[model samples]
Target: MIGAMWKGMSGIYQQDRGIAVESNNLANSSTVGHKKDQITFADLLYTNGGMGHGVGSQSVSKQFQQGQIVGTGVGIDVALEGKGFMVVRSRENPDEIFYTRAGNLVQAKDGFLVNQDDYKMQGLVPQSRLTSSTNPADTMFTDEFARNIVSTNISNSLGRIFNINAKTTDYASSAKNDDIAQKGDNYKSSQSKINDVDALREDYINKLKEYQLTPNVPEISSQAQKSQVDFSSKISSLTSEDNKLSITVGNKTFSVEFDHDGNINQDEMEKLYNFLDDSGREKYGLIDPSSIPTQDDIDNMPITTPEEIQAKADRQSLRDNSINAYSSAKSLVKAMQDLSDKISAYAGYSSSAKSGTLEIEGLIQGKEFKISEVELNNEKINSTNIQEAIKGSGMAMIDSAKEALKQAVEKADAKYLEITNVLDYADLNTIGMTDLNVRLDVLGLADKDVADVEISDDGFIFVKSGDNKFLVGRLSTASFRNEQGLNPAGGNLYSQTDLSGNPFNADTMNTIKGKSLERANVDYGTTLTQIMVYQKAFEANSKSITTSDEFLQTAIGLIK
Candidate 1:
C-alpha cells in the first residue's frame, strides 16, 4: 500500500506538469507567435524479470499549427499569411531576437520600425534604389537649355537693331548726294546737267526747260570762261547716275529697297530707319527675353527719345520682319537644346510633336487589399465603410470578410492547380502575373464579384474558404533539445538543442492555414487525456512493488 501510494504520487506529479502546460496556453491565447505544449509519458520499468519502476512524464512537445491573426487594420498588425514565425525582440531589450507569432509592428519615435516585442525587423531596405534612366543633373541642365534659347534670341534681336543705327549714316550720305545734284551742281545758267536723266529730279528740270521755257544749257563761249564767272558743263558729271537706297521702316519688311531713280525722300527714309530701330528695342525688350536675373529693367527699356517715336511706323515693321527670319531660327535651335536636356534627365518623360507624356512606374507597400468582392456580414469592409457602418448599424459599412475569405481560398486553389499542371513552371510571363494586383478598395466587400479561393506557398496554404476559420492550418510540428542552446541571448525562445541538431522552419506539405489565424493547439482535452495515462502506469508499477513486499512478509511469517 505504501509502494502504491508513492507510485500514485508520481503520477500526480506528471498530471501536474500537464496542468502547467494547459495554464500556459490559456495565459497566452492572445500572445503573438505562441505555441502550445503536449505531454506524453514512458513507463520507467516493464512487467518482466525483476521489480519495475513507476511511470514518468517523458516528452513535452509542441504543435506548430497556424495561429489566427486577427485583422486590426493597423499597419503594425502583421499576420503570417502562410508559414514562419515573426522573429521579434523583447520590449526590454530589443537587441535579442525571439521566434514568435506576434507581428504587431509600429514605427519608433526616431523612425525605425519595431515589432510587438520591439524587435527591429531585418531587411532595412526592401528594394535597392531604383536604377532610373535619368540623372538629377541632367534635369537641371534641360531647364537651363530652355532658358538659353530665349537669351540667344534676345541678343540676336539686339544686334539687328544696332546695325540699323549704324546704317543711318550711310543713308544720310546718299541723300546728300541727291540734294547736291538737284541744286544744279553750281549757282546758274546752262544748268541742264542739274539732275540725272534716270532720276525724278532730272525729269522735273527737263520739263521746266522744254515746255515751261526754264533756262537751257546754252553753249558757253571762250569769253564766258575769261570773265570772272565760270559757266561749265561740270553739272552733268556731278549728276552721273547711281542707284539710291530706300529704307522702308514699318511698311512690311525690315527692308532696304533700292531703285535706279531718286524717287525716295531722304528725310522720310531717315525717319523710317530711326523708327524701325527704336521700335525694335521696345518690342525686343517686351519679348520675354532670357531668364537672366542679371538684366537691368531700366537699361533694356525701349524708346526714350521723341525722334524714335516719330519713326515708329517704320520701326514696327522692321521688328515684325526680324521675328520671322533670324529670330525664328534662333528660337528653334534653343527649343531643341532645351528638349534634349530635359529628355536626358526625366526618365518618365517622352516627347512627340503630338504631345509629350510622362509615365512613372513605382510600387508602394501595405496598401490595403480586400479579400472579397461581395458584401456580407454587418461589418464594414474598408476604412470609409467603417465610419458609416459604425454610425448607422454600429459599423462603417457592409463587412464582406466571409466573401473575402472565400476568394482567398479560391485563389490559392487555382494557383496550386496551375502550378502542379505545369510541373516545372519557371517563366513568369506565361502566367500573366503582371496584373497580379490585389486591391483593398473597400473594407467590407468590393462592388466587383470575386470567387472563393485558396493561396498556397512553399511553407503552407491559406484555407480562406467560406468563413470556416476554426479548422484553418494543417501544420507539421517538431521540437529540439535545449531550445536555449541555439545561441544568442534569449527572448524566451529556445533554438534547436545541441542534442537535437540544426533547427529549420517547415509547414504542412498539403495543408491549409486559417486565412487569418488558428486557435492555439494546446487543448485542455488533450491534457486531461495525458493525466489518465500517467495515473494508470504509475498504479501498475506500485502494485508490482507492493506484491514483492507482500510475498517477502508471508515468507518471514512461515519461517517463524
Candidate 2:
C-alpha cells in the first residue's frame, strides 16, 4: 500500500508537469517564430523484475517544426522559408551574439538595422571601408561578427554591420567634375558639385549628350558649274567687221554675228527680239512689245526741215548701229541677253548681263552639265577666270568644318567613356548588408530620401529614391549542422553551443519572403487534447492515493 501510494504521488507530479508544458504551448500558439514544446514521460525506476516504480517527466524539448508564413505587407518584415536563422548581435552587449528566425526588422535612429529587441543584425560588407578603396572583393568575412559596429579603431577583417548614412558628396571630387567639364564648353566654367546619386547620373548623361554629334554638311544631290565673264566689255573692243560670239549648252549651240559697220545684224536682232516676245507670251501669257523699239516705228516719225531730217537720220543710224548701248559705251548687252535666253531653254542654267559683265549659273546642285565652249571674236577665254574651275576652294571650307565637328565628338566620347568606366567599377565593387542606411551609403544614395523599399527573392534589398533605385544591402542568414543542440537564450533567440557547432552560411535552397513573418508552430487543438489527457491521468493518480489512504484507515480500525 505504501509503495502504491508513492507511485501515485510520482505519477501526480509527472502529470502536472505534462499539463504545464501543454499549457505553455497553447499560450504561445500565436507567437511569431515560436516553436512548440513537447514533454516526454518515462518510468522512474524498475524493481521486482521489470515492475515500474512510478511515472516521471523525462524531458521538454522544442519541436522545431516549420511555422506558417503570414504576410504583413511591411517593408522590413522577412520570413525564412527553409532551415536557417537570421544572425544578430545584442545592442546591450556587443560581444554577445544570438540567432533568431524572427525578421521584424526596423531602422534605428542611428541608421542601423535591428530586430524588435533592438538587436543589431549581422551581414557582410564591401571589402574596403565605404569611404576608401575603389576596388573591393566579393568574399566572406573571416570573423563571424558584422563590421557595422561604430568604433574608433579600424579592424583588419572585412566583415562589418551596415551603416547607410553616406551621400554622393562623399565620393564627389573636383577631378571627376573636370572630366565632365572637358566634354563641352557650356560646362567648362560651371563646375557643379554632385549632391546625390541622381544628380551624379544626370551630370554624366548631360555630358554624354554633348558628344552625340550629327554631321551637318549640306547634301549635294547633283554636280553644278558656274561661270562669270565681262562679255559686254570685251565685245565693245571688237575692231573686226566679223565679230562673232558663240556658246554651246548640252546639244545646242547659239551664235551672234556683227555686220561690217560693227553693228549687230538688223535682221538677226529683230528676229531675236520677236522670239523673246513670243516666248514671254507663251510662258507668262503676256507679250512685251515695248521692251524693244521696232524699225517700222522709227521710219514712220515725221520731219520738219532738212536739218531736223538730217538730225533724225543720224539718231536713227546710231540707234540701229549701237543697239542703244549704255552711256554710248556700245556694250553688247542686248546681244548677250538674247543669246542667254536661247541657251537657258536648252540647258538647266540661267544667265544675266549687267554693267558689261555676263554671269551664268547651273540651276541643279549636282547634275553634270557644262558650258562646253565659249568664244569671243575668235579668241578662247581662259577656264581659270570662271568660278566653277576653282570650286575646290569652297569644298575645302566645308571639309574644314567637318573635321572640327569630328574632333569635338571624339573628345567628348572619350571623356564619356572614362566616366562610364568609373561608374562600372563602383557598381562592381559595391557590397550588400542588412542595414538600409549602410547599403545606401555604399551605393552613394544616402542623401536622397527613400521612396520605397523592396526585398528580392534572392535576398537583395533595394530602395527607391526619387526616380532611381539603389541596392541597399542583402539579408544574411546562418545555418547550423545540429540545430536541435542550440541553447535557448529566451525571447525567441538561440546561442551556439559545442553540440550545435558554429554558424555557417546557409544552404542555397533557403530563401526569404519579404513583408511576411513566420507564425508559432504550436497547434492549439493538439495542445488542448493533451491537456485533457493529463487532467484524466492526474485524477486517476489522486484516486489511487485516496484508495490507499482508505485501505490504511480500514487496517488501523481493524487492529484497534
Which parts of model 2 are misplaced by more than 4 Å? 128-444, 448-453
Assess the local accuracy of residue 247 in candidate 1 as a C-alpha lDDT between 0 and 100: 14
TM-score each candidate. 0.34, 0.48
lDDT (C-alpha) at residue 275 in model 1: 25
List, residue by residue over 1-560, the lDDT tens digit for candidate 1.
45555565676666667667666667766565566666677767756766545658887676666665464533233455444443444456545434544444454543333554455543211111111111222211111121110000001111110000000011111222213212211111112111111122222222222322212233221100000111111111212133111111112111111122223233433322232234333432323223212223323446568765545544555444443333322222222223322321221111111111111110001012121221112121221111111111100111122112122222222110000000112222221111111111111111222223222222121212122111111122222333423432333244444564543432321222233433444555764565566456546645656775787688789999
Predicted model with the maximum lDDT? 2
> Would you give me the overall lDDT of model 1?
0.30
Determine which window of 10 residues in candidate 1 has minimal summed lDDT. 160-169
lDDT of 1 at 392: 12
